[model samples]
Target: MKAFYDTGELACVALDAVTGPQVFLSGFPLAGSDPEQGQQFLLDHAAEHGHCVLYTPDDSLSLTDLGVLLRSQQVGAARLTRPLFVKEEWLESQYFRDHLPLEGGSD
Candidate 1:
C-alpha cells in the first residue's frame, strides 16, 4: 500500500496495481506521527494481501518519523515493509541505481 500525506496527515492509500495507484483516504484524519494507527489502518486494508509497503513523498516525513512508524508496526505485529519516503526524482535515480550493471561481472 502506498500512502500520500500532507503535513503528516495521511491523504491517500493505494491498495493494489489494479486499483490504478490513486486512492485517497477520506472521511477521517490519518496522521503519520501516529504509527500504531497507521499500522492498524494498513492491516485493516491489507491484512489478507500480505506484507505492505508504504510510499510517501519526501517532504511528508523525516527518517526519524519513518523509523518510529516502522518500530510501531513491528511492536504491533503488522506485516509492513519499510516505508519509502522519496521524491519523484529520487525514485528515478533509485531505478537506475538498482539496475546499473556492476563493473566486475563474470568474464
Candidate 2:
C-alpha cells in the first residue's frame, strides 16, 4: 500500500482498494474510550468471521480491563502479549491447569 501526502497543507487524495482482513491492535489517546463499540465491531465482524484472538500491547490500560471487555462477549477472546512476566514452566503449568485442550498430548 502506497500513501502519498503533502508535508504541509493537504490536497484531495483518494484511492480505493479491496483489501483482506485487517487486524488493528493499538492503544492511544482515544477521543472517547468506547470499549463497547469497539468490541461490538470486532465481535460482529472480525471475531464472527474467525478472528477470535486479538493481541494488544497498549499500556494505557491494564490487561485485566481489556480482557474483561473482550471476554465480556460470549464470542470473542482477547490476549495481551508483551512484557511477559510468567516463566515458561509456570506458563505451561497454568495452561495445562486452565486450558487443558491447549496442552495437546503432554502428559
Candidate 3:
C-alpha cells in the first residue's frame, strides 16, 4: 500500500492498483480539521481512478455527514461513492494496521 496524503493525523492510502473499488481510510486522530480537503482529495482520486470506498471509524464523523459534504461540493455521480463505517476494534485484526504506525508512539 502507498500513502497518498499524510497530514500527521489522518492519512489517505492507496491499498492497491486495482482498477475498481478504491479504498480510502479516515479517522486517524484529528481528522476533523479541514474535512473538505480530504473529501475533495478522495473525490478527485475516485473520479480519476474509479469507485471509492471510504472506511472511517465508527466513533468518527458519520457517513451521512460525508455524504452531505460530497453533495454540497457536487463531487461526482452517486454511483461512484461508497462509505463504510468500521468499528475501531476491527483495525487490530488487520495486518496492514501494524505496518503503518500511528503519528505518535504506538498506543
TM-score of each: 0.24, 0.21, 0.25
Q: How many clashes would you count in candidate 1?
A: 0
For all candidates in order, the CA lDDT equals 0.32, 0.26, 0.32
Model 2 per-residue lDDT tens digits across residues 1-47:
12222355331111111121122345321122244554455455544
The order by descending TM-score is 3, 1, 2
TM-score of 1: 0.24
Model 1 residue 20 distance off true place after TM-score fit, in angstroms = 24
Q: What is the lDDT of candidate 2?
A: 0.26
RMSD to native, candidate 3: 14.1
Q: What's the CA error at residue 50 for candidate 1, in Å?
A: 7.6
Candidate maximizing TM-score? 3
Alpha-carbon runs more than 4 Å astray in model 3: 1-35, 58-103
- Cα RMSD for candidates in order: 15.4, 18.6, 14.1
Q: What are the runs in model 2 whose C-alpha is more than 4 Å off?
A: 1-32, 53-107
Q: On TM-score, who's better, 1 or 2?
A: 1
